[model samples]
Target: MASRALRAVVAVSTLLAAFTPASAQEAVVNVYTFRQPDLIKPALDAFTTETGIRTEVLFVDKGLEDRIAAEGENSPADVIVTVDIARLSAAKAKGVTQALEDETVNSNIPASYRDPENHWFGLTKRARVFYAYNARVPEKVMSYAALSDPRWKGRLCSRSGQHEHNLALFSAAILHWGEQRTEEWLRGIKANLSAAPSGMERDQVKAIAEGRCDLAIGNADQVGFMQTNARSPEQQEWAKAIHIVFPLFENGATHVNIAGAALARYAPHRDNAVKLIQFLSSPRGQQIMAEQNFEYPVEPRLKASTVVQSFGPLTADALLMDEIENTRQLASEIVGRIGYDNGPER
Candidate 1:
């Protein structure tokens, strides 16, 4: 249907469009991210607006360490942004991340939120919570040990036990209760699953809304996503069906996880990478993440978004990062040994 002249220039137009003049000379920082792209874009865009440094992002759902290692020294990954402390530890262990000892970055974040050797820095904090169908479930607060009660034998729903989120929680449990007790606790949880470990945190929320389960374990941000999901109106219904219950450990503190950033070891654009990270740790950067992603900022002066704050006060346990990272492999092994993924017996 196109004119002959227009048809003749289409391929040429496409070729020319592929190579922008700025691509050849502008400062650019490449990022490998495990967190959703939209979640970090506001802060990255703010960074570019402030410093004129273009950010290039690649999303990898899994195996980021192996991919970065495969690329070796030629990897264009100047920065890595991801969730879960275990993955960050693994990247450093794999020698893909370099220590970042920036004074500006250090001043912006707390020592508890950044690595001791400075390989990664926590950007945002989110709680691991329970979504319970309010109409059917009355009791609000829960102790992790209560998960095994026979009353919940067919009411519990979760993502895979080996998932980084769940694994991190299990690792924390190992440190809190010891491996023998943690394994027994995991076995009890497995015995109560409504379905086989399946889908994402959002899917577990959906299951609760459908009345297929009464209690679902998931991260707090999924509730924010569902409530704000204009693209999927049905998800708003899911959000309305339940109330978030912050599960407590025996010591009365809740489990929290972070989304963090690191510098790649072989970064070609080292200065630009450091600049991006520094910007990401600034008050403006922290604000952007808090407002857009429904997460708690790493900066103590700033508070979580209003929606996040409404989930109830988060009493974070004094979890040691090194201890949690060290115990994660054992957590995965326990999941395997007990066949936690097999779900409850019919």
Candidate 2:
């Protein structure tokens, strides 16, 4: 099983030396994060050791931006870390975040991964991938364009087309295929739904394991989570039932979305906040993130942990995340306009 799982990830490469801590008064940085505290503890610990600055964290699953806004200018939050461009953009739109002007952060992260306006910076990337029932599906590779084929009608499963994951996926479609063709793809997927798109990607995988469908769509990191799931052993069976394939756009690039961070607008410890963010993009911080969460690091030279590399090689798209993000609203509208969640028209 270790050998099998080992092959799932493709080792990305290692990182350079850790960065020198920035100059700052010994102070505390208050954090508001949507990610679990334990997931980021290693990097946070390293930050303290390097900078002599303590970190106080507040963890929440959602509404991070809204909560910061509710706290107003006096909000203690210095940094806000969360997943998805939707949330990151929402924080910027709500004026809960401020533009970060730091050369360390700018140099560590490429322009493609950060907001053009510098409101947020990406720390990691994850792929939207396809899962096939190993015994029933012989194909090892898939293209997103092929999902619309009639051969897959009633044999495919996915979460709602409007979910942020799918919306991001479709938004890429808009970039690669244009609106008319992307609309056609959505309609075709709707026509092919095994049942009305419902539940999460896990549910779609569960259905595949049960033989309700032969193919499913889901995030690659999710499979990593399911494989290592100790609390719910049944998830292991779901992971075992399928092999993941990185789906490519028409231009031959896989789609990836970011998990990034922004500075709180009223950050009381502005200098400390900049240090934490820069450290996060540093080789050491990126290494901690890659190993801890099993995600691809935003740093160009860092590789994913052995466990994550097992998922497969990810050839992320040339399209800037901001480009994909720009089209998400249109993607959502298309999902709504076509009644994507209502299932194939009878």
Q: Highest lDDT among the candidates is held by which one?
A: 1
Candidate 2 regions exceeding 4 Å error are: 1-26
Query: What is candidate 1's lDDT per residue for 1-346, written digit by digit as tens?
Result: 4787797688755633442223334598888898889888989999999999988887888899888898787677889998879888889999999999899999998887889999999888778888999888887798888888888988999999989899888888888899999999988888999889999999998999999999988998889989999999999999999999989998998887778899999887889999999999888888788778787787767888888888887887678666677888999999999999999878
TM-score of each: 0.89, 0.90
**Number of clashes recorded per candidate:** 0, 6
Output the lDDT of residue 204, model 2. Answer: 79
The global Cα lDDT (0 to 1) of model 2 is: 0.85
Model 1 misplaced stretches (Cα beyond 4 Å): 1-26
Clash pairs (backbone) in predicted model 2: 8-310, 8-311, 9-309, 9-310, 9-311, 10-309
lDDT of each: 0.86, 0.85
RMSD of 1: 5.5
TM for candidate 1 is: 0.89
Q: For residues 218-317, could you state the per-residue lDDT of candidate 2 as single tens digits?
A: 8887888888889999999998999998888767788888888899998877889999999998888878876777688887578888887887788888
